[model samples]
Target: MTESVQAWFFLLLAFVGGVSAAAFSFRLLGYLAVSLRRPRDLRRRYGAWAVVTGPTSGIGRSVALKLARKGLNLVLLDLSAANLQETSDMIRSRHGVKTRTVVFDLSLVGTPQGDDSMRRLRAAIDGLDVGVLVNNAGVARPSVAYLHEADVELWVRMLKVNLWALTEVTAAVLPGMVERGRGAVLNMGSASSEAIPSFPLNTIYASTKRYVAKFSRSLYVEYRNKGIDVQCQVTHNQPISRPAFKFHQQE
Candidate 1:
């Protein structure tokens, strides 16, 4: 082609590309603006007695603090005694709300009565009405780069903690919530469950989170009319990761 003709063709292509880019940028900016302007109050119509697992740090800590400030009695659980105590102290001192701590390994798949550590946890706090249950205890591992490098038992244990333990505790508290005809179950799930990524090693952990999200949604559909609110928080951004924090389903 002639130089003049080629130059004109390239110019046209650049113009189209610029227009497309500008359109995308405008849309993104508008979305961000709307998100920034929206109100974020929890909007609870009734009071609660909240239970938060993995309340030692990060999102769990924030959730616990928020509930405490909102005047909800808090039950904070973690495997770390120091962290659990710290959370309890913060809530009691700062918010002046009632706070209880249970430092037992919840990754084990049963009630506290079945295990000595858990029994102590139960014995410490009993005959109380728990209105909101936050099943937020979870972990990912020592970087299993290869399938063979992964410990099958450890993987199962993680599932037992992430899935089964949460289930048991919720089971223990659920009947009460139903009997009262009002309560909330907040499950901390991961966004990896929604869009399956190609990352190796984190597959099993991710799958467990996916199960949590699915379970929470299914429960909501079944029980929302009964005045029960089941909220699953699927977080995309974590403290250790480079992504932004968001929930798949937020109400």
Candidate 2:
């Protein structure tokens, strides 16, 4: 009986080790494949124009600049007109590519005015050969607080901006991608989506981010064969409090 128990333990240990090694190897290969892709590959696989929501600041701005550098023309969307214009100008100057800006608040997604804004957004991209859509606009409460302590208004705003806006924008853009038979949609997610460590004091924010991951994964599976690549980029780091370059001139 003792010998049999020892054999079973060793077998279990070996199986776990093998699984871990295989997971690591697969991840390494995936990273290597992504690293090997060039800017031209993006243009060829996706298209020429890339749309970035929340392009005025933070990670959205960074993504917009990188895509511009890769020879993609830009359609920038944000709430601040001045900031959107500044981002558009910078992309044109640095990358020598064309850029168009659309300024609209995402927090009012279900309102009549929001519908008009969506119509405008669709109109703006109508004739363009858009290749990539980055649904990066989102909001969080100003500070962390327990569920009952959190501001009710902020919670509603977070849901609109983080969840509703993402779905609306993707719906508007995805049909075009499907018709064209080639495009990419990148949804920004948070590390909290994994929920392994259990985030505290920010329940609403974490839940919304978790929704983004599940939504993106579902879309990816649905459209993988239709030449649409959907990805949820899970970020672990917090946004920079101060950006190095001010993309917009202060009003």
Candidate 3:
């Protein structure tokens, strides 16, 4: 082969490698920045109170604790009243931050029971300065059956809980934030949606998370000028080296 051909081949290879490296570097730095930022910034910029859903376990519980440590009062929501009480007590005891619990079941979106829960939630935060909202309550079908294998009811229930519930809860808190003109809204998204080429068995879950990403982007554009910072955190259940505070709109 001619030297000119060899030179062009190496140049193309170098260009591709450089682009890939830069993309990865930016992603790593993004994670590092989120892990390093002080949590107190949320309270200082937004308000004194924050609301977190599904605070009884997992990432929700972690986020609740982090916000509490930042000296923000917490409103905890979960399906189990006992679990909510337990988490609320722990937060209060550990951080000495005021904590309130509301039994919230995101799955019952269209039912009387869910409506009652919404009413209670509204009452709980009535007339309070709620500035940070973490919409973390989500559910995935327990089994890994293919879409056709599962009953239609199962997918419908997942939709209600994962997508509709988050939207309803956000709408509930967002107006209050708008009136106050300063707030931060964080939505829990999934890595299966945009990060991967395909998610075989978890189709509905991935679709709902894609919805979350789009919803968050629209909210960011609509409300950023109004002093609201909307962020969608695309996360995976797999372990990671850094904290899961990574957000789409932060950088």
* Each model's total of backbone clashes: 3, 0, 0
Please rank every candidate by TM-score, starting with the best: 3, 2, 1
Count of clashes in candidate 2: 0
Question: 179, model 3: CA deviation in Å?
Answer: 0.8
10 residues in a row with least lDDT, candidate 2: 242-251
Give the number of the best model, judged by lDDT.
3
- RMSD, each candidate, Å? 6.0, 6.5, 4.3
Point out where model 2 deviates above 4 Å: 1-26, 37-40, 195-197, 236-251
TM-score of 2: 0.83
> Model 1: per-residue lDDT, tens digit, 1-251?
99999999999999999999999999899668756874333324323577788888877888888777677788788888888887798789998888878777876555444376556556544666666777877877635646577887787778888788877777766766777777778787776776566556677777887778778777787767766778666554322221112332221
| Backbone collision tally, model 3 | 0
What residue pairs clash in candidate 1, if any at all?
A: 107-161, 112-118, 112-119
| lDDT, candidate 3, 1-251, per-residue tens | 99999999999999999999999999899778767876546676788899999888888888888888878899999999889889998999999999888897888987999999999999999988999999888877844778888888888988998899898889999998899998888888777876798788888888887888888888888888788888777654321211223432210
What is the alpha-carbon lDDT for the whole of candidate 3?
0.82
Of candidates 3 and 2, the better by lDDT:
3
Candidate 1 residue spans exceeding 4 A from truth: 1-46, 111-126, 142-144, 236-251
Number of the candidate with higher TM-score, 1 or 2: 2
